[model samples]
Target chain A: MNAAVTATRGATALDIAAIRRDFPILHQSVNGKPLVYLDNAASSQRPKSVIEAVSRYYEHDHANVHRGVHTLSQRATDAYEGARETIRRFINARDTKEIVFTRGTTEAVNLVAQSFARPGFQPGDEILISALEHHANIVPWQLLREQVGAVLKVIPISEQGEVDFVEFEKLIGPRTRLLALAHVSNALGTIVPVEKFIKVAKQHGVPVLLDGAQAIPHTPVDVQALGCDFYCFSSHKMLGPTGMGVLYGRKELLEAMPPWQGGGDMILSVSFEKTTFNQLPWKFEAGTPHIAGAIGLAAAIDYLETIGMERIAAYEHELLEYATDRLSRVPGLRIVGTAANKAAVVSFTLEGIHPHDIGTILDTEGVAIRTGHHCAMPVMEFFNIPATARASMSFYNTREEIDRLAAALEHTRKVLG
Target chain B: MDLKDLYRDVIVDHNRHPRNFGKLEPADVHADGHNPLCGDRLTMYANLEGEHIKDVKFEGSGCAISVASASLLTEAVKGKSKSEVKELFDDVHALLTQHDAAVDPARLGKLAALSGVREFPARVKCASLCWHTLNAALDRAAEPVSTE
Candidate 1:
């Protein structure tokens, strides 16, 4: 395959300087030095459009959405519903009803655990999740296992951090009710072959819920093409506002499942004796939602749309390669995940030196990085390390920033030694 | 002088050549403490002479702050009574946590070098996890000796 093929007519480099200008926080200092914010996996810094959209909603369109006869209500409802449509188009979902807004990815997973998995789960029914899952993906299924007598099966990964497909296939049986996995690993940055995995799960008559929390921000995601039953992702991780997230479920599946929560907006009618439920989306979105959050997310989607996801992904891929090569040359340094298909996250450990020490020294030089298990303790256990120093990147990250990181790591080795 | 003045040559020397940094066989008390937040792990062994800590040895993985703090702690507690060690630990902890830059320097000894850590609040765990675990180990021994 021509891996180094020239860009096609449609392919263009992302204007990062122009893009960087959209995000105000990118220009700042930390620890008396310029901040190189590489911790995008934890959460992304919001663009000005997203930030302004949120403020605008609260300033101008501040009212309860859905069923208000007033103009402000209609305006608020339009903005909120408009945000839903933006995400629906972004993920390429079939209908707006499939995109149910939730607090974030954690709530989205819990919604599925409570509404879908909890009701049908029985003894011998297995829930297969990868070793690279964040605690959000792990704990909800654990709670469901305790509640519904379901068994939690782990899909192991190779030392290089790619999910062991053969082992994953072996774990999948007729008993597997669900295959919940991160689309892109929060710790390792291994972008799993999710579309293929979804197809395999479908063959087994099992549903797949992708934790697209990391994937959506970095790459293009199409629910229709992936053919997954559900996809969940947090807006905050995608340069949007914090409190909002999207859960894309197949319409038939969502309609069949009972509502996870009961409140005003979710119900069609209620009496002391009985209660009736509303339609999809609203049925899942109970009470007053994060109005400004939805507005902000829509603006974030617009920002990504303007830049183009493919260009962003390609740029980040280049940055990842540059960073990997740079970090690999450092003596006594070992890269944790070397999966062929990965995002821009590079997790590594220095020989005989603790990650905390690495993080502290780097911070002293004005480079901020995340150091620890990264909330994926199983991945840490897999590597047999207590923790790792992770430098996650986004479209904003540059090769120069990566050089800064490399220089800081070298300085750390000298200082700590 | 600012707290950065606290990172004196003495502190760096102790951090580089940590005192009593080895395992004690047949140790009277052995305990391990980990700061899960930062992933610093420390294992400490103490040979008790009745209520007094005859010897305290430490081995683990951590940042310079934690290793240095542990080294300073070992030096301060040697030859002191168990009660004196407890009192000294309290005094050192209070000194580190104090917001006032004018904390009396006489009480902290070489441990005073960590006053710089207070400026970087995030590293407080790196500086204190070992000390907190030492207190836990001592309390667990419970021969009229409270570690905290």
Candidate 2:
């Protein structure tokens, strides 16, 4: 468990050496260079503990949940349900009934759109979202808009990439049926002050859905504290397994809405005439869930809990600052998203070289980064760029990695020069 | 593999100064090429002189691989017939995608520089976008050919 050589240490840092060692994938080489994974925003590498948890579940406790009376089924059900409780506690949601296991953030948004918002939405009812939303947040609403004739409105962002709170105030009128926004812009790393937006939405009697796919990994998220009606996040973005996510809807809201999908576990009892649905969360969880994925997520949460989200957040803020400063020094480089508040993502463009070229050169250096629109084409459209090379960070990443990224950019300049 | 293998001097030169890098108006054959993965957009125009390419031009924006490939395609296909160009496309496609594909120096000419794309599997589409679009143009298809 070698601590990666970092140039500086944050005052409230987790021992990054110990953190990096927990994830075995970081020890590998790419193109003969140590792998510098800066694509956490896309997907994170799983730690050994989380990996083993999935293996352990499949090896010893593999069974269909909430059905079989066998010990394995009971064990699987307990572990899966226990994961829900753990997530409820993690986000400080009031009850486990409020947490619905979704396939991922996309599914969670679709669930809300189909189950929650679709039922109540009237023709020309406006669904308000910020300009900074990822495709996951934007496209689902667009689909609902197309389906129900709901008007989709965007809260504009500033040049610095902050949500225009004044514009948001004007946009939250009576016809605004729901407000969905990115908690943090995945493309730009702009941390929208969602709390302020939520407050305004509440006064307008509009429910808020925060796309927490990017936010949950880097920061502490308390659904109660945030006071958003629904907070959707993916597990893979938070070091859990892919295809696993949690939708934290308010309890009364969950109780009131009809389930999006109906199948085996979601039903109370079925007959030729009629079938009563299951209560609360299980009603939305239609089929046999990702049993092992839930257990792996719980293990991931345990690992994050051990590190503590606040400590991780604090350390990552420092990492962001260091990365920003280091990356800004590269000639002809312009940081695309320059919000005062950002996650550990640094999206940038070189003056002459296309981001694709930068990405290619960086790959040669084993510095993996996200290139192109990053599923936020509107954000790129707003910025007047075709694409950017985004180097998003995580708790396990180091200053040395940022240094490597900068050095690679310098090499990229030389190579493309 | 070396980055030099991917970004050879010839590739970089073509990228910097793409030949026939604009629209050919009132053309007999025209088609657009799009690689949606990287947002590479290319509009290709060809003036056909009884199936022999009289003139060819392109206008668009993309990465080095894409731009250079388009530039090289315009130069290589001018005097060649549509059938010859189609065969050239097959040869260039193989050269770009297959690591073990042999390059016939005389046939490929400067277009042989595209053989570097074989080292970058992700970039094979970028190098062949113009070829696909040109093939579509040859068939008189109006739809934009996409390298997805």
Candidate 3:
């Protein structure tokens, strides 16, 4: 994009240009063109503060956390646990003990599946999930189903991509042990109204697990206010490093559930005869955790805090509207997801052109978009489409980049039409 | 580097009007190819006359590069012996992956159009899926070939 186009800013609260400067990766060029990164839903780009925080940790305070009497170990332990507190405060969780850092959202869901559902669920019990769930949320339950005769039931969605709440009411029955749902659809950007579902699940004596991987970056999540038993989200999706995420479980439920994995960190005392597990949070985090990732995630939270989540949400919604309007004008373009309430994601398809080809061509023009089933095959099956080209925006993304994307898409249609 | 390199006139034309498309009922050899990443799936069917391919058809959906490559494969492999088809497959594989591979138009003919897929690394699987499905048919494999 030219300087003039890049300079054009939306009427918003946050200074878009300053926000873009914080993320160094956004300044580079790709394929000899200015990078228009629309792949935020996959993994958001980290700001300089986050990058520096991780580097600073390794430089000055590098040691195995929570163990030794060495100064560096104490420092590392303080920082690691402090980061956990940061995440707890970010999500408004009542206690840091509720926040168990996992490898990512997938592992968090797996922990709930193995430790919570696998042991507790009876034969012929149903684990209900929505059609909009990513493979992370859906597969863990399938594994539990295979292990414990737990029947997996899906709450179908409409063609418009919203979760079918009426069908969900029917699906929640006496044997329904849990209702796992995606707070925001990664592929379609449908902001599911999970509060209603959570209320219904509570009435039926069922617990709800909210997959916040796609929602954390775009919206404000309060586990207590949302009334969900478990809330899972990945750090990388919110401008942090990968290999780190948080599983916010209710303290009582977590106390009852057995540890998913046992390793050095998760054990209180181990002998040949018996081994006692560590306390809350540590009991679930086996082996060494991603200490640096946690620190970087804390820095990311600080950055988001300075900017404010509600303000970012408002700006991103504006960007989504601008993108939808622009992309709609492109010949043969069809926006796939159009829920009344959505995040800054536009999953679209150009007529007579496959999404793979669209992605390839867009790459040549320096536009990065996710093009596939997006690990949500069931959602694709519902839409009756092979795949969609998803342009997912962030707070730093501007209208100018979306214009470049639209233009590149026009070129794509010409080439592949 | 350029769009023309990937979507050449011949490739685009083939994508617009794929040859030997749709189901071939009572096919002596059949196999399905699924690229799970992009959801590009195609079932290749062949009626074999001894070691020779008497007829071949495909049915499914995929990207332009994949559909065009499959279309070109059907045209190039028709009435060819198993050994001959194997040779052509080796050449097309090279053309789609190895950028510096030598192409002899005398042997490759129109399949040379797929050489552009070499520039796009991610699309390489898209171009080669049909060939793998075809090989599965030739080998009489029971499982569908998946490009994970």
Best by lDDT: 3
* Per-residue C-alpha lDDT of model 2 across residues A1-417, encoded as one tens digit per residue: 243555445568567777788899999899999899999999998999999999999999999999999999999999999999999999999999999999899999999999998888889899999888899998998899888899999989999999999999998898998999999999999998888889989899999999999999989999999999999999999989999998999999999999888799999999989999998889999988999889999999999999999888998898899999999899999999999999999999998788899899999999999999999999988998888899999989998888889999999999878
Q: Count clashes in each candidate, considering only residues at least 3 apart in sequence or on different chains.
A: 0, 1, 0
Best by DockQ: 3
- DockQ (C-alpha based) per candidate is 0.43, 0.71, 0.82
> Model 2 misses residue B98 by how many Å?
2.0
Reference-based TM-score of each model: 0.94, 0.97, 0.97
- Which regions of candidate 1 deviate over 4 angstroms? A1-10, B1-16, B101-104, B143-148
lDDT of 2 by residue, B1-148 (tens): 7899888898898888999999888887888988776878899998877768899999998999999999999999998898899899889988987778876868899998888788888899889899999888888733455769
Give the distance in Å from residue A67's predicted Cα in candidate 3 to where it truly belongs.
1.3
Which pairs, if any, clash in model 2?
A: A3-A17
Every candidate's lDDT: 0.85, 0.90, 0.91
Q: Quote the positional error of residue A378 for candidate 3 in Å.
A: 0.5
lDDT score at residue B37, model 3, on the 0-100 scale: 88
